[model samples]
Target chain A: MALDQSAQLSDDALLMLYANGDPGAASELTARLAPRLLPFCNRMLQDLAEAEDVVQESMLRLWKMAPDWVPGAAKPSTWLFRVASNLCTDRLRKRRGVGLEEIAEPADDRPGAEAQLIQAERLSALDAALQTLPERQRQAVVLRHIEGMSNPEIGEILEISVEAVESLTARGKRALAAALAGRKEELGL
Target chain B: MTGPNDRIDEFELDALFEEARGESPTPSDDLVARIVQDAAQMQPKPASSEGHEPTGVFRQFLAAIGGWPALGGLATAAITGVYIGVAQPGLVGVTAAELEDLDYVSTEIWPSDDLFFEEG
Candidate 1:
């Protein structure tokens, strides 16, 4: 089948197609999911290179698991997010004295020079503030706001109650605001 | 009254976060390529090992020489035939050679009893 045609399928359907030997399903799933998983992983790990590795590993795991995947048991995206989150947590534990220097400068795409600089500063401030949050809180906030996932889905990915997810996001956002307290004027908030 | 500096409100903080989200870095072209390559490599192979194996020559020979069930029946018949002959020989048909031996043994025993009476 054409990749565009497969694009209309759900992530679960696409994975089923891929398991059944549909060549286009793999590419369709990759294009559809890599962008989301990569950015989320980058935010969690704060290292682009490691995040990339985690994304690749996470996708590889999905491919390996496609054969046994139970349809309707869970959404493919949620499962992949869970896998990436665990991988990030493992890497974070092994990291020794993580420093701000390891944070990759995000891609700046704004048109004007001043706008681009301000955007860069805002992203930097946000990233630094995020890094200060506890790992679970940071994960909850990123998945909630940045990834645009609902509380139940975030709960599923993090294996927590929806109430816990809500609590984590609330605390995380408050902490982030405190961390970025003086940067509001520069960030144009 | 809320001070102007009372950290950013939820709405403004949300807007700032939304902007920051927009600036999230995409994976490098090389990284995407690597992940696609990994996907290609990890595609699940077709499972075809569930069927039974092809029957070999030894199995064919066994089938030809009265497979297990047939052989078992034959063994049971042989055992029953042996048991009937030994336990109740009368059920067996009498043969002429066995009758001749029985007559000779009867005459020899009676004639020897007459010789014993004359000697007494």
Candidate 2:
């Protein structure tokens, strides 16, 4: 799973491996892409389980596209992010208001119970506020903040101009900060 | 890592982003393992992507080569190159050498006559 660059094949390499029916490519691709993409989906859907499904489906598409998929037109990571984002948006549109649990944190293997509860509360507040925004704003905010992606990267992922990505993100952050105004205390940020 | 092009860069946003990324909400290991195991068991459906051509095929081909993980792709290309290059010239050269070994050139005049003329 792209561990230590041993399996750290390039997108083209992975695609070739994929073409040669190397399943390792799939795993490596997942390892590299999933963490970055998951939060965006989780924020978008406000449902961790659904976001996980979206990640799987996104990887599935990569697998399916391997045979005919070429490399170089777009960044593989970016393409996957875009596809995952679209899938999450679709899922959100299909099932509105799930009142889902906070963005499910990975079961924290460390820390005391009090710390865990506090983190959970922060996540819950953030998730709720994110869920209340308009879809476009949500996408912008998630991609920019949650995913820590740049404007140009977000632009390409969202299929919009860089300027537009910036604009959307600006509006989104303002809206989010407003939605989350009183929630910072719970967030401890 | 705020920069000239950055649109949003408040401490609050940065904190949120950090918290979002820092959380371990990644799918459970069991789930990841299941996905991996399920993947391990999967067999390629068609086995050959050669027949399936998509729109912007060339573009996708280029895209695959655009990243750091393309060693397999590069190897595949190198292998193909060797197959095309060596298989044709090296294979054909050895075959031509073998053909020369089997070639029989007949001479009407004998070397013994020329030896007699030289000695006598």
Top-DockQ candidate index: 1
> Model 1: per-residue lDDT, tens digit, A1-189?
886688688999999988987777888888888899988988887778889999999999999999899999999999999999999998887774575455554333334425234666677767877888899999999999988999999999999999999999999999987876654555567
Each candidate: fraction of true contacts kept?
Answer: 0.55, 0.21
Q: State the RMSD for candidate 2.
A: 17.3
lDDT per residue as tens, model 1, B60-97: 86688779888788789999877665454442555677
Computed on alpha carbons, the lDDT of every model, listed in order, comes to: 0.80, 0.67
Q: Please identify model 1 stretches exceeding 4 Å from their true place.
A: A97-117, B1-6, B46-120
Candidate maximizing lDDT: 1
What does DockQ give for each predicted structure?
A: 0.30, 0.11
Candidate 2 Cα misplacement greater than 4 A, ranges: A1-5, A97-117, A183-189, B1-9, B37-120
Report residue A71 deviation for candidate 1 (angstroms). Answer: 0.4
TM-score of each: 0.70, 0.62
**Over the stretch B1-120, how does candidate 2's per-residue lDDT look in tens digits?**
323333223677667667867774777665566556645555364455558656486667767778545866788899978755544433334555665886654433324334334653
**Which whole-number lDDT from 0 to 100 does residue B11 have in model 2?**
77
Q: Which pairs of residues clash in candidate 1, taking residues 3 or more apart in a chain or in different chains?
A: none
